[model samples]
Target: MRRLLWLTAAALLAAGCSAAPGGEAAADKQPAPRPLGGVLHHTAAEAAALHRAEEREVRECMASRGFEYSAVPVGDGVRRRAAGNPYGLLTRAVAAQDGYGLTVERLQRHPADPNAQRVSALAEGDRRGWEAALKGTRDGPREEIELPDGPTVSVPTDACATVARRALYGASWDRDRYTVHSLADTIVRETLGHTLVRAAEREWAACMRDEGYRYEHRKDPLEELEKRLDTAGSDPAALRTNGREELRIAVRDAACQVEAGLAEQVSRAQEQVEKALPPARTSRLEEFRAAREGALRRAGARAASTT
Candidate 1:
C-alpha cells in the first residue's frame, strides 16, 4: 500500500487592521497598521478596542475586495477564561485561491505576538491531544504493518502511515496558521524563507572565504550519500547503512548551525517588525518556516533510509 501525502496551503487574508473597542469613536481609535499586516496591541483594553476596529475594517476590506462578513460573539462563560476577551467574528469572501467559492471562518485572536516557543508549544499540545484521542479509540488488538521497500519511497497506504501523515500535515498547517497573520503575510513569509536561507548561506560562504576557512557547503548530504550508494550498487545495503548514519550526523551538525543562525535572525526580524507593529499580533512567520524546512529535511532523510 502506497500512502499519498498531499498538503494544500491555506489561503489567508488579513482580516484587516482592527480596533479594540470603543463606542462612537471606535473607528477613530483604530491602531496604526503594522508593516507585517494587522495591528497588535498589548493590554486587553487596547486589544479589545483594536479588535472592534479590525472587525469593522476586515468587513470593509472584504467588501472592497468583494466579500461578506459577520460577527459571532463568544458567550460569557468562555469569554471570561480568555483574558481581555474580545468578541470574535467570521468573514466569508471569494478569493482567487478559493476558486471564487464562499469561504467563512472566525478569525483567531492569538494570545500574543507570534513567537517560535509559543508556536512550537501550541503544536506539541495539539499533537498530544490528537494522539490521546487516537489511543482512546484503539482498544483492539495490535498488528504489525509493513512499509514499502526502497531508498526513497512514498508513504504507505497502511492505517499507521495514514495516521502519521495526517498528524504530520495537521501539525504543519497548525504551525502555518499560528504564524500567519494574513494571507499576504503567509505568502511573504514563505517566499522570504526560501530567499533568505539561500542569501544567508551565501553570506556564510563569503564569511568563510574572508576567514580563509576551507569548509565545503554541501547542499544535501542525503543526495551525496545516494550517489555513492549508486556507485557501490553491488553492496547497496552496506553503503546505504553507512550513508544513513553519516547523513544523520551531518544533519545534527547542520541543524545546530541552522538553529543558531535562526535564533539571531528571528530576534532581528522580530525587533524590526515590532518597531512597525503593535505588541499583540506581530508575526514570527519566518522563524516558523525556517524550523519547518529543517524538520522536512530531516524527515526526508529518515524516510529515504526507512523505505
Candidate 2:
C-alpha cells in the first residue's frame, strides 16, 4: 500500500510542470536558482536542538550545492511520528527523507569482515554511499521560484509537498469511489450465485420427475410425501447441506469478484498517480506497476480457481 501510494505521489508531482500561477511572475524577475541537496540527521536531541539541526542541515547542504534552501515540513504527521518512536523510527525516516526514491547501489570493493563491529561499520558505510550516489544523480529538473532569501532553491516541482497533498486530499475520494464499486460487484456476484442455486434445484426436480414420481400437481402433503418416498428417502439434512454449500459457493465467487475489482482499481489509481511524476521516474514506476499487476493477476486467478 505504501509503495502504491508513493507511485501515485511521484505521478502527481511529475504532471506537466505548468508554471505555478505566481511562479512565472517571480521567474521573469529573477535568475534561475541552483539545485539543492539535503541530509537527514537522526541523532538523539531535544526538540529545540533537533529543529535547529534539521534547519541547519537544509541550509548547509543547499549552500554546498550552490543553492539557497529552506526547510519545510512535508506534512504535520512527521512531528507526530517523531514523537511516537523517536529512536526506532528515525532510521527509516532519515533514509527516505530526500524522497526521490531508494538510493541505487554501486557496489564497492570492500574487504570481507568477520568481526561484528566491523560488519556493522561496513553496512553503515554502504548505506551512506548509496545515499550520496542518489544525491549525485539527476532525479529531475532544478525548478526555480521566489523565496524569502531572494532566488532560492525552490522545492522541486516534483517534491513531496504535492505527493503528501494528493494522498491527503484525494485518497478518501479514491477510497469512497472504490468502495461503491466493490459493493456493486459483490452484489452482482452474490445474485449470480443465487441464480446458480435456483438452477440446481430445478435440475434436481427434473431428475426426480424422470424417476417417475407422479403427483407433481398434488396439493396434499400426504400425497406429495407418498410420491417422494416412493422415489427416495426424504432427508431434510440433504436440503440443508445443499443450502450451506450454495452459500459457501456464493461466498467464494463473491470474494474472487472483490479481489479482481480491488486489483483493477489499484492499477488504475496507480496509473493516475504516475502521470504526475517526472518522465524518467514515471518510466521506472510504470515498470514496477506492470510487474505488480502480473503478480496480482496470477495470485487472484489461482485463488479464484482453487476449491
Whole-model Cα lDDT per candidate?
0.33, 0.31
Listed per model in order, the count of residue pairs whose N, CA or C atoms clash below 3 Å is 18, 8
Tens digits of per-residue lDDT, candidate 1, 66-140, equal: 323442232222322222111111011111112111111111233442223433555676644433332322443
How far off is residue 305 in model 1, in Å? 36
The TM-score obtained by model 1 is 0.23
Where model 2 places Cα greater than 4 Å from the true spot, the runs are: 1-48, 73-75, 82-134, 138-307
Candidate 2 residue lDDT tens string, 1-307: 3333334433443332232234323322332111010011122333333333334444455455443344442332333333322111111122222121111111112233222343245567664443332243246543443322223443332333322322322323222323333333433334333433334334433443453433222122234333433443334444223223322222222222222232233334333433443443222333333333443444344345643
- TM-score for each predicted model, relative to the true structure: 0.23, 0.15
Candidate 1 local accuracy as lDDT? 0.33
